[model samples]
Target: MDFSVRTVRADEWERARDIRLAALQDPAAPIAFLETYEGASAQPDSFWRERTEGGSESGGGRVRQFVAETSDGRWVGTVSVLVERPSDEVRFGAPAKVDQTHLVGVFVRPEARGTGVIDALFRAAVDWSWTLPEPAIQRVRLYVHEDNARAAAFYRRFGFVATGETVAMPGDESAFEIEYELPRPEAGA
Candidate 1:
């Protein structure tokens, strides 16, 4: 169960694609992710390549993707953070009201779920968010489908609190995705 967590490299597109497809196959995919397996699978290699590169280290500071890889080189988990500036177009939910990062594309293999890989991935993501220069990240936020209790529980355990904001789930107006946030820690704390 030994694994290391690190930002994904620009050249790791195939590995990124594989892990993302696997996540879309997980039973929780219906609630955990906005992308469908069918949709993702239909994308061409070029699409994946561009998407992966945009989230990798070469993507500049706007986005970052972190992966947990076993000693044998199997990527088992991933989380992506997208920097959101107040003037940036919103990717989901409401437009950013402050400088922040949105956590998305979270996944951990079933076998790696309880091995602390998730915690490590999240730590790297949030820690990286706080380190972004200029404007300063005021918070790290994510949206969870209301029906996804397991994910909500874990977010709460990780110190994210519900922001009293709800947005209609895309393509399903009746359902809601609740916003959760962890504010930046007080300076010198």
Candidate 2:
């Protein structure tokens, strides 16, 4: 509750990389993220810089990353949204059937959990998605590992309903990830 949520800046790549590395080490990382801590940490500084730059405010309208920073300037949470157009190639499970934004790389420090940081981060991400100009985004979606009950619960509480779509988790065809989405709200409602 003491933190403020806002889009990330290109210059803050180092901070972004640090928080992400922390997230990848969380116990839930296996189910919550497609990449492993080892894989991410092994990435060079250049990779982190490019990745952060691509999602920063100056990173063209294709993607945006929001972070929750405390009054002291520590970033405790983050959520990135990737704008997907019907004509664009798919990045994960499926191709975009409509103008939509895929929410990814969601994370909140363990100490920051249950303190409203996640909610604030999500609100910022979703609000930004809805505000995109031209071929407006029609929906916001995310995939959760089938066994990630905690994440699914939060997504449901946040108004994202399960779309009943499932795809094999990458690198592990035996496991599945379910899709959940929040359709654009009606005007004034």
Candidate 3:
């Protein structure tokens, strides 16, 4: 794909914010993202700073953000993974049963959608989950809106089997989030 997948730097908060806002403006944003572009764009610079740092290595927040940079040095895609410890509160429901990496905030620029950037970004996120040291991740998971068939298909193709887990959408009736997981590699196999 000729794209460079790498962790985002904490200092690149501005760039991060730009891409995220752009993603929110995409046609599928209503079902693909929880936050609106208007909301994100209105957030203070401090918000972006904290969010960027929280997902960067230097922040030590147990979360990582990976960006797919094109040959021209533009960030065309991004995916963030948040490590969830067993004791931590479940992101939107029950506490995690085992240590895991919860993938979120995935987005690819409209122009880069079909150029293999999504696969590359996903690989980077999944690989990072297994590479963590403290608490050692056991699995990687992501949630997709029930109606996002296009994304659901891609998740299936990427080896994230549906765990049959479902979470009701917050403050919304007749909507649910379907969970999919990527199993970790076994030791000494």
Q: Find the candidate with the highest lDDT and give its number.
A: 1
Residue pairs with clashing backbones, model 1: none
Ranked candidates, highest TM-score first? 1, 2, 3
The whole-model lDDT of each prediction reads 0.94, 0.93, 0.88
> Of the candidates numbered 2 and 3, which has the greater lDDT value?
2
| Candidate 1 all-Cα RMSD | 0.7
| Model 1: how far residue 19 lies from native, Å | 0.5
For residues 114-182, what per-residue lDDT tens digits would candidate 1 score against the true structure? 999999999999999999999999999999999999999999999999999999988889999999999
TM-score of 1: 0.98
In terms of lDDT, the poorest run of 10 residues in model 3 is 87-96
Give lDDT tens digits, candidate 2, residues 1-189.
599998888888899899999999999999999999999999999998988888888889798999999999999999999999999999987889999999999999988999999999899999999999979999999999999999999999999999989999888899999999999999999
- What lDDT is reached at residue 114 by model 3? 86
Residue pairs with clashing backbones, model 3: none
If both were scored by lDDT, which would come out higher, candidate 1 or candidate 2? Answer: 1
User: How do all models score by TM-score?
Assistant: 0.98, 0.98, 0.95
Clashes of each: 0, 0, 0
